[model samples]
Target: MRPQQGMIPWGPNTTAGGRAGTQGGEGAVELVMVNPTEQAAIPRGGNSLQSQPDGKGHFGGVHGGRFVAETLMPLILELEAAYAKAKADPAFQAELAYYLKDYVGRPSPLWFARRMTEKLGGAKIYLKREELNHTGSHKLNNVMGQILLARRMGRTRIVAETGAGQHGVATATVCALFGLKCVIYMGATDVERQKPNVFRMRLLGAEVVPVTSGAGTLKDAMNDAMRDWVANVADTYMLIGTVAGPHPYPAMVRDFQSVIGEETKAQMQAAEGRLPDVVVAAIGGGSNAMGIFYPFLDDSSVRLIGVEAAGHGLDSGKTAASIERGRPGVLHGNRTYLLQNADGQIEEAHSISAGLDYPGVGPEHSWLHDIGRAEYVGITDGEALEAFTFCTEMEGIIPALESAHAIAHTVKIAPTLPKDALIAVSLSGRGDKDIFTVAEHLGVTL
Candidate 1:
């Protein structure tokens, strides 16, 4: 079923097609979706961006569609069809749920940040501990879901891209479990910097290819992965790492990761007896943030905040703060906010954290920002570094640097809120892979 803005879109219409609406049980099937209230308000030269696609598979309104070469377009279309069929099948959902519980460790805790809350002294903070997942990051949520769909499509191999190496490791881990041949394209720079994760992927029986063009980060790596998928279209499955890319991918990845928000909603009600006052996560290609933000879109009382990477500072001309600083543009096969210049050429993004160093974000986030359903902000490397230290020392949680960005923003806003106010942070990944970078930044040897 198309994930709409509701507590549970899995009612009567979830199968065969979602009801007109899942909750209200009215409307057409909108997979890359939005509630009626959600639509693109941002005008481009006087026209509004298409925010919601109907049954025709318009994807993410005007912001997302298949924007690839004709040869690759057919592959994307086939994947979309396969996914729709799989979602409608009871067996597919059953098996996916079973593996999520038995293998990838679902229902990640929404633990109250007792120490951090007391330390902040204002808002109560709860962490959706996605870091505790088997692969140590939220990336596996998407990888596993896509791989299952890939298998059903009769695809025999998997190809993916990674930046900080967390995704690469996660993809490789799952590939080995299913005995699928896996190839992960990573930036040459990332392969060198995130060595632990690189070694982990290699040990998991996946081939890692390093791309050297562009700034040697996620975007470059994605380009290479897309190329590989096109060249080997018949047998290869391109497992996109995040909620970016085109059409069904952003929608597909968001649905897979939505489990984070799904669990958080139940856990928050169970923990605090009500919904959180605010939900926060860092946005790179925006999957983690989307996972946590999607469920709460219709809750007017709850604030959804996305923190982007501000490499040095927003004004430093070296930031990955796309939603905050970018204008409308197309990149990586979908139209979305992008770091571009006067001539509309894509600019390289800079962030100390490899995972957050992308020039574009998931298209749904772009739509959300335009519609004012969510807020986007920027956190700098220095601030994120300090936040990383805070979580490590104060809470004994050495968060992934990308998660540190959200933590940094949390401390800034949480302390300013009322004492009873609540904030839920998606601690999206663990810090083991980031230890080397953190140590080097601190001028210390590990």
Candidate 2:
């Protein structure tokens, strides 16, 4: 069968060594999925999606790269080298593992949502309980890894950007644990809406700086953090919260967050004796989605779905569904799908969930979308809110608004699939930080 536009033409039974034909004669490489025990057996340069970007950071031949100011090149290069060294060192791995298991509470449970599954009445639903992490989100996974790397590099100060404040909170928590100075740049709007998280950051000894530029959201916060990094390259390490940045960051953060996927794979096998039928996650900068999607990339039988926040609707000119309604463009240092206009001006994205309010998605996600390795869909704010309430009532779980987007999509598709279909959704964070925002939307004053 011919491949559809923007999708790779690989059949379900395609093996690891299979080559898929793409449009315009661009050859596509198929990824090989391996069992957890055999992961080390795969060759370093094999045809796996995990070993992507080809040393230049460009995924699928085009989606990622270091498009940063020349001033930051030295620092970026230094970070890349340090991270590479740390990755290869067993000592660094052991340190990071200790912190993750003891402090951050990793290997979060894979919960079977019996109530939600019965309510949906089709697919069996399993929620990857990232919310159970110490910082109340999967943000801790990446933050812990980066903070340890920063310590290894002898950086005494750490800077970061946040939208929903989960990343900010997680970064601050780690910095506090290590006694490093922390500075979090948050959009003014986010700072206002996510006051609880802002307070949490402050309590954790992080100085929160509010950026008032560009709709006062994640993109603006990232811009300010990058500026701060450029000015203080001597002692400051920029702890990026997501997977949308330059070369080493996109790959580095993915490596750190891949633990989520790895755990899910093993846990799913233990629970069901096989891989899950579908893996679902919400996409903001696409970290959580990438974290959960990376391990299963080569498993042709397992479907990967990423749900983007559609603030109003896909066509309403105000949505964060970058992969769905956007074109490829450069933003936040990487070439990816962005919500831009006719003149290529970056458009402000809209979403009730601050985390998913960015105008661009991760470059890896763009590559995956182009190659049909995964599917992305948009969930409107209303739908997410509904799911938020439904999940709370049905599963007794309060999912962060960001994760509610994934749950909303699951609510839609679960009923359509067969009863035995297994679906795993990344509950990336708790709803505690989103209570104020949700209250206001529901016309309740708290």
Candidate 3:
């Protein structure tokens, strides 16, 4: 029997909702009615969560489709093909691995936070130290991979959009390493707040362009970068900073950033003899969270929690909790949950951390949320600030404002769990870039 328009088939006698499925023998057939929206959270063939977005980049048949202009269609297709080819090539893999290890610094440590655990007095906490990587953030993983792909495609110039400027700095650093022209589009507001990173980009020979449109934030910068790419299609590549763009980009960026999750898995096994009970990471465009969550998708025992920036409070008009307060909409060439008004117009998102100040989230995150494969929560700016101070004082590790959001959520839940429970938080970046912002918020003269 054909299921309803919004419904799908599930295994017999199983729960009727979520992307739940069971492995079956060859030619085995069983059907139970389920809402299509809730189906396929875990892929069917072998229950592997990684087997997603078959071909067209749509996660769970709802989010993520190529919604770009005709002028960019051919280029998008070319990029999709190039990425697929490169992903399968052993030579490409070896080269990327070499650069990641020798230059970008792979296998960042997973430190057990003894003080944090003692303070919480509940779950044992582990910090995935991506902040120690070159450029001081996980952004370098995607940037390095994309820049290498750009070179393979014979592109001599690279364009990127950044919010907190970590991505811009990473892109600029790689461009300088490879002698390619680099151009970064950052929001005017971000340019002012992240002046140090802006200077670093310029020093590395990148042209930093301040985008003044649309609240002067990451969304505006992305808009400008897309325009630049459309105009300079030839000899230019757009290295999207996060996994929130058109086809291949969301998937491609996730694959590159997956290194974090992959390494964390191995490290956790070696340290604790098993997978973590929960994984936590902050979500701006959700690259870091997706990176760590992707590897654990199949591990049903591990809970994945994504913390979105709640600028003021979740109910406050000023906030960046897209998944918590958004509806599905197409933005920046992909269909995802966006903070929009009743008229379907995108709303301005506010966050103390510039990196999380975007109106939409990656489509995969939306799909995961719908399928109940992951859980997302909001951390208010005040909560994050408190966590920041606590982490610095207790652990002596100053985390980036983006990572502070995750820490805030961890702080909330750690005390409630059992002592043996383990939680791993992705310390995505260092706090050096955010000291000024923190000081200003604390009413201190820096």
Question: What are the per-residue Cα lDDT tens digits for candidate 2 across 1-446?
Answer: 11134443222321222111111111212212212223333343355665576566777667778999998988888988898777766677778778888898776888999999998899999999999999899999899889989998999999999998999999999998989999999999999988889999999999999999888989999999999999999999999989889978988888788888877877777777778999999999999999888878877899999999989999999899999999998887889999999899999999999999999999889888988889999999999999999999998999999999999999999999999999999999999888888999999999
Higher-lDDT candidate of 1 and 3: 3
Please list the residue runs of candidate 3 whose C-alpha ends up more than 4 Å from where it truly belongs after superposition.
Answer: 1-46
Ranking by TM-score: 2, 3, 1
lDDT to native, each model: 0.81, 0.85, 0.86
TM-score of 2: 0.92
Q: Positional deviation of 354 in candidate 3, in angstroms?
A: 0.4
lDDT for model 2 comes to 0.85
Question: What would the TM-scores of all predictions be?
Answer: 0.89, 0.92, 0.91
Lowest summed lDDT over 10 consecutive residues: which window, candidate 3?
8-17
lDDT of 3 by residue, 149-241 (tens): 999999999999999999999999999999999999999999999999999999999999999997899999999999999999988999999
Question: Which ten-residue region of model 1 has the weakest summed lDDT?
Answer: 37-46
Top of the candidates by lDDT: 3
Measured by TM-score, the strongest candidate is 2
